[model samples]
Target: MSLPFLILYFYLMNFIYNILVHIAYGIIHFLSLFNQKLQLFIKGRKETFKKLSVIQSTDKTIWIHTASLGEFEQGRPIIESLKNTYPTHKIIVTFFSPSGYEIRKNYALADVICYLPFDTKKNMQNFVRAIQPELAIIVKYEFWPNLLSQLKKEGIKTILVSGIFREKQLFFKPYGKWMRSFLTAFDHLFVQNENSKKLLNTINYNNVTVSGDTRFDRVYEILQQDNTLDFINEFKYNTYTVVAGSTWKEGEELLVNYINEHASENEKFIIAPHTINSKKINELRNSILKKTILYSERNQVDLKEYQVFIIDTIGLLTKVYSYANAAYVGGGLLTGLHNILEPATFGIPVVFGGNNYTKFQEANDLIRLKGSKAITNQHEFNSIFTTLKQDVNVRTTMGKTCGDYVKNNTGATQLILNYINNLFQ
Candidate 1:
């Protein structure tokens, strides 16, 4: 291409990217008004004003940034470890997405849980001046070019934990020079696998380590906690139960079809969708032929008789899976993959729709081990679910595989915590 055409192409592509992001931000802001949980997100920045004031008064502060609730949870062990190791430093937590800030605004460990402003030069300049963090940690794939560069300029030691990279991502592309600068700002890039480390090395970014994924540790922690859910126990009643978590509409549709055609009269099912929009709840209820209960509306007794139960609330999915014999994970269809680790830790074989899941280590690993299966449509769903249900030995063997996979992946949280401890020492 000629020089003028190349310049025009770059300008247009940049323009489109900015426009799309801005439009998405506006839509998120608009949507936050109607939902109570979402309103908490819209008001997250305002809510952090008091916390920021407190931090401003403190002498030493450590700043941790996470993109969403998943990242927040993944970084929880590290945050707790930091607080325990260095009790004197104030922890300032920031989120680029409202989903992260809204869920964790009231976290007692964090002095502040604010929405990070758009990563503009002025925003980073002002934010860095105000917070003045002694140390900075970013969870997962949250690299903002201006913010990272500003942190480096301020002599703040920036670290990335539980990070992952793939061959297809922008950083690996030929014209990714500008994007690669963000990766370079990290003092240490603690990635999930050797693949991520290799990709970073290709960009001449050598300050990296393979720390594995902290989420495995997080889910294992959940397993060690008391696994008691009275309602789920009554519904399960020593029967084989399938817990389908974080299901999107596409996955749910396929599940309903499979249940209609093949699910035995004795077996039970539990569904926790990614989002519990009332419309989605009703749609799922309408689609299924068997007796069903919405977790929000049903009493404990109501769920016991139903073959399927739809979880309409958040925060209960991990606990609900404790009673499951098998689990069908959600997010693979349209959105992304939900927490396969939560169910896998319980030693339950998992199922899900397939797409956009190169980042999920446990899911990919489980498939390779034959403890998890991915389906493209109703036909595949029926085949997988039918075989697992009818064959007891296969079910038990796969369940064992699921448990073992989780056991081996433990200690990422500890590895990260050890790194943080070494820094202060």
Candidate 2:
């Protein structure tokens, strides 16, 4: 309100904007080096309005934003819902990262898919003005202050879908006063759990609902599709299989160590590491004393000769779980957590690192149902794996428990669709 305070506020805002602009500049350079296509790809999005002028669409669009590939996967069910429910509505999708945009740019449901321009005030204003969406849905944890403020200024009906929150986050921190303003910009937030709702309530932003997670819906859909891999089928024949899906180095180390020490004659192991780079694959092979086969180099695989089959590829981890008797979803052992719902949908028991049960709701549910276990070290891993392997009855029971957990948590997509329809109606 006062002249001095107003000037100070403006100065701080400008300073922050400059920092973001520099960060954006660095990101642009980084993306350009690895792939020229990515460079040319995002160069166009920097001025999306000029590009969109050629499309000649007079209809209002429903815009959705996702941070990366995982969020896009979570939002896939919502996209399918929109197609079935509101066939006439035009849809636009945007991603902030190359990992998201690159993977799903060819998505059939979305009318347009591109990188969301940097969150500069001008870019946000230009984007909002060009698209003029009737409704906007933001997925997961991505929040850009400039974009949110601009959307609020334009009176857009914005909502956060499959939302999550944690106490350690800046929004709940006492000193995060300026950061808290971003939460108020949303008209509604469809949170995944009670923890998120409580966190939002603490900030006086209570337009929130507990809608569960949409990824369960997506993973369930995968099971309905044809899941037979010709090469994989020959490899998993009539053997007690332990699938390590989305594994990192830490997980692989733990698993390799356990398998080497125990040496079960009836059991076979499959590993799908998160990074399938040649160096990493070779390292994994060298780590194991057993004869290992890489998926990339060979076509047909024999299950009997080589007990360990290393999946040195991507996009096959989820499908491979269909053939698994038990699975270990990776990421928690190191730093990040992998997708647990993928393995659970196949009705297989899952194991992971102890650090991950915090953010993963399905992991918690499976643990409650006695379908999954979280182990901190090799001893616990050996004990849990051995128990599940030896006793077929225990494996069958735990598998049922995991399947029930997935079945119970399947309606988040429907709830989100209902909320969106009510707003339009």
Please give the CA lDDT of all the candidate structures.
0.81, 0.82
TM-score between candidate 2 and the true structure: 0.89
Worst 10 residues of 2 by lDDT: 48-57
TM-score of each: 0.89, 0.89
Candidate 2 ranges beyond 4 A from true positions = 1-24, 27-57, 300-304
Write candidate 1's Cα lDDT for 1-425 as tens digits: 68798778766765665577668657877998787776665576555445566655456889888888888888888888788888888888888666566557789997667887666566678788778987798999877766887998888878999998999988889887557756767889899999999998988888888989988888888877998988887777788888898888888888898788788888889998887689878988999998888887676455677898889887798899898888998888778887788898988788877775656887788889998888887788888788888899989999999999988988888877777777877
- Winning candidate number (lDDT): 2
Worst ten in a row by lDDT for model 1: 48-57
Position 152, candidate 2: lDDT: 91
How close to the true structure is residue 404 of candidate 1, measured as C-alpha lDDT? 92
